[model samples]
Each structure stands twice: as structure tokens, then as C-alpha cells.
Target: MALAGLKVIEIAGLAPAPFAGKVLADFGADVVRVDRSTSTMNLDVLAQNKRSIALNLKSPAGIEALIRLCEKADVVIEPFRPGVMERLGLGPEVLLKRNPRLIYARMTGFGQEGHYAKMAGHDINYLAISGVLNERSKSGKGQVVDAAMINGVNYLGSFVYNMNKAGALFQTPAGTGQLDGGAHFYDTYKTKDGLFMAVGAIEVEFYKLLLKGLELDEERDKLPEQTDSSNWPKMKALFTKIFLGKTQAEWIKIFDLTDACVTPVLDYYSMPTPTPAPRLLRTPAKASASNEGSDVFLEVGGHSKDILAEAGFSEVEIRDLVAKKAVAGAGLEKSSL
Candidate 1:
């Protein structure tokens, strides 16, 4: 429950990358957000509950300050194009040498090395490349990138990215390790009332219980049906259909009762219980517009300090960073979608 004395340094940036760091921070990591000195990120949702130190990574002093900060950090997260950090002279090699055990988490749309590594991207690109985006939107209209619009739209929505990064922190091979290289029993299914439940289990009997609880006909039809190794496709399809048929609460009723691996989908405002995701914990439900402690990083590519610094800068930054330059600070003003 507590990361205790662990220290994390997040290079001020976007949602998923920073949210990953926020998760670590909440559990007691001393998370220091390295904000761009000229960053107008006055209301960063992900960076809340953490400390902020503005530094112009483009400046030699700023980069050195970061290196000094890294010397005391256990992890440093950055979500730049493959070489942006290296180009800024703040790459893993420099930081790792200073802090050998430091988890140098490089968050990217594509991975460290790939055809798209150097290219700019977001969750959409990562999901699209892995075929997850396509798979999520393959039916009927066959949207080109609904995953891009929904899941791939923000940093936190990139569950694959966060899970992978968290894995690397706990595993060996240091920072270059894989994030998604764990057990493969991840799944989501629906209840009779049509709500979806995400499932994770390694035991065969657990999987059987899951299928049985969901009343998957295809799974029931399989021979030696009780075995976990039975073809999971039919059941998986049934699960997809069942969830698509109902709202999330109806499914939670039955799913939460069974010992089967399952959990209902929840959003920021609709957590079923006392939750612990970082953003939720740090943000004050009723904060003054001028509350000094709240800060979050809004990453925008292609800008110099002079351009990014100005009185109207925060609003302009918000607009440019968010949809059509609308300055919705930290999304607090917007109703939950």
C-alpha cells in the first residue's frame, strides 16, 4: 500500500505517462514533476499531489538541474518521441549512470525502437500499431480509429502503456524491460443484465466459473467443458455480447458476488468504493480557482520558451493542448463524458 521512501521524477508531460507516475506517487513515492519553466500547466490533473519544479530542459542549467534531481530519484518518466530526451541531454544513459537502480520509464505511442519511434504519436498510434485499436472497432461501421478517439485519446486511457511501465519497475533487465510481458488471462465479459466485467485469473477453474457465471452457450457446448483450456473464443464472444447489452451496474451486482475474476468499469466520478487512483486522490472536489497546490503538465510539441510564455499563456496553452484551444483547466469545468 505504500511505496514508502521511493522517489519519482516525472518529466512534465501528458496524461498516461504522468498518470503512471501519479500512481506511484500516491502510494508514497516522492513524485517531483519537472515542469517546463514556461509551462502554463496551472491545472494539471495528473500532476496533482506531487511537487513541481519548473526547468527549461532546452536550457543547459535546466537539464543539469534535472540531472541533479535524478540523482535522488528512484524513477523518471518521460513521454517524448524516441530521441527528444536524449536530444535534450536528459536521456536514460545519463540518468541511469547517475542512479543505477532508477527506473527510467520512457512512455511513447510506439516503443523505444520501431519504425514509428521517432514519429510523434499518442495512445491512438500505440493501439493502432498493436492492432488493439482496430480490434475494438472492427464491427459494423468499422471505424478507422474509434480506439484513437476513445481509449487512445488520453494518456490514462492507455492501460497497456501504464501496465507495461509498472511491470518494468517491478521486473529485471532494468529500464529496457518489457511492460506487457506478463500472464495472459486478461479478459472482459458481461452479466445477464448486460453490464461488462473485466476478468483476470490464471487458474483454470476460475476461468470455468467465469464462463459458467456468464452462461456462455458456446463455452457450454464445448466438450470437456469444465477445463480451462477449452476454446475461449466462443465464451469471449458471448462475453462481448453480454456486456454490450446492459449498463455497468447490473453486471457489477452479480460479478461482485461471485468469486470469479471480474470488476465493473468505473469512471472518475463513479468509483464504486473508496478508490486510490492518483488523480482522484489529489484533486480537491471543491478547490478555489487560485488554489496554489494544484498543478498538471500539458504537453505540446514544437514550441520555444518565448512562444510558450505569456500572460494569456495558460488559456492559450489550454486551448492549443485541448480541443480547439478551449481553456478547460484540468477538465474540472467539464462534465464527465
Candidate 2:
């Protein structure tokens, strides 16, 4: 709901542009997708929580209508090749001049001005061009073993048994295994504020850092050897008491960046919710020939009467535009998540 009441005019296109609009819509922005009236490319995959108005950008009336929409909009999402908007007279300069506070976005594959700016590409194409395709995780050749989760976990017993053979596991009782909440450094401790902090400082260096962050002086505290299982119960007791002295937030302040493997066990409400991406905080989209541009048009939109009226289009003008095939009055037949 952070973007509620914000007006966004999204020039319909493929994944990148429509996805940006979808995110804004998800965050409660009032998005109006500008789709081509004659095209039937429905961008419903990312059209949730948005409205649409079909327009024939190739026509003069359609371009004028789009200008009007952007004149009062908080944001305009343009997904076209570099010169496409300029050729259609819908470039950012004209829109920003009409509404200086407007936020114009250009969603493109290669960007506004690049060797491939005007070229057609998608996620895979860009990844390939960026050499991401060459970076693949390959494993040693072996008999492939793919199975359902229920079956896969059962087969993993062979690997677990292999570890159990080296006297490296199950050395203690069921609750005292080194990685199974048995080691004091590999368990969760309660904080003074009733929250919990998870500790995984198993490595020697990490354990030292954890102790340092905990202010546990080696000489003064006379701590037992870390690997001495005979003294683990005592260590657990000490860690439990020490952790209870501070709140989770206080502990995080000390260990968050210390590489101590200590972190708060956050609940859903305590976690940071991810917001939309590719945003313009300052220096919003400006009109310039050298700016980024794209060339991808998708058809979608409806509710032309209401949207056009909001853009100051006259009742008669709206009817005439529709009559001229420059605008459409119906919206997407259906949309979903």
C-alpha cells in the first residue's frame, strides 16, 4: 500500500515494462496501461491491480491523448526503442514539460542508447549477450539420480550413514550432536527482549569472532576448549545466560557485520518486505535525444471513457477517437495474478 493514490501511465510492452507496472500496482499505485487499440497482445501476466486504456499510438489523436494522460500523472512507464517515442511525439521531454514533476521510466533490454538498444531481446537474449550463459554450474559426470522429495530424502540416508561412520557424528546423545542444536555455538538462544538469535559460529575463526562480539575475554573468562565435548554443557549454560543479557536488536548491532554467524531469528512481521525495483528517487526521466529508449508495443486497456475524462478529454472527443480507431472503450476481458 506504499504507492496508493500514485498515478502511473505504463506504455504496454513485454516483460520488463509491464513487470515494472505490475510491481507498482502491487504496491498500490494507480496504474493505467496504454495498449494499442488494434493489437491483441494481452499483458495479463503482470496486469493485476491496474487499469488499461487502448490507444493507437500510430495515430495523431492517440498521441495527444497519451500526452494528456502523462500531463497529470505521477509516473509514465515507456517501453520502446530509443526513437520510437520521439517519432510518435510521446517522448519524456514533451511529457515532463507538461508535468515537470513527472517520473518517466524507459524499460528496455539493452537500454536507451547502446549498440543493441534498438535490437530485439528478452531475458535469455540479454543474459546470453552479457555472457551469463557461459557461467553454468556443471557437476562431475555420474549416473543421474532425480527423484521426488519424498523419495530423494530417503535416498539421502546413504550419505548420512557415510558421515555416521567416521565417528564424526552422533558422538553424543540424540540432542547432543555437534550440528543438531547440541553445540552451544550451533543453536538458538533467547534474548532479553523475548526474541531469539540463531548462532552458527562453528568454524574456529567464526567462533573467535562470536566470542569477541560477545565480549567474552579468553583469559578472564577461562573458557573451556571449544572442541572439548566434556565441557559443552557448561558452555551452553554460559552462552544461554550471556545471550539473555541483551535484546535481539542489541545483539545484532554487535554481530550483524562481524562475520560471527549470529543473526536474529525474525518472524514474518519483523522482516523487511521487498518493495518494487528500478525506481527513480531523484533526477526523474528527462527529455533528451541521447536518453535510453526501446521499441516494444503491447496491446491492452479499457475503461477509456473514465481514463480519458481524467485526462481532460471531452465526451465528444472520446467518442470520436474511438470512432477513428485511435482509442478503445473496453478493457481487458479478464486479468489475474
Model 2 agreement with the true structure over 1-337: per-residue lDDT tens digits? 4677789898877676777787777667888998778866663456656777888888888888888888888778777767788888877667777876676676666656657867876555764554211211243111211112223234455666567788767767878888877888899999999999999998999999999988897779899888887788899999999999999989989998888999999898777644445455552221112211221222355566678878788767876777677887553222110
- Whose lDDT is greatest here? 2
Clashing residue pairs, backbone N/CA/C < 3 A, model 1: 16-155, 44-296, 164-179, 194-246, 319-325
TM-score of each prediction: 0.47, 0.49
Candidate 1 residue lDDT tens string, 145-178: 1112222444544674575578623354423222
Residue 240, candidate 2: Cα error in Å is 38
Model 1: residues >4 Å from true position, as ranges?
97-101, 131-268, 273-337
* Highest TM-score scorer: 2
Model 2 CA deviation exceeding 4 Å by range: 131-299, 331-337
Worst ten in a row by lDDT for model 2 = 140-149
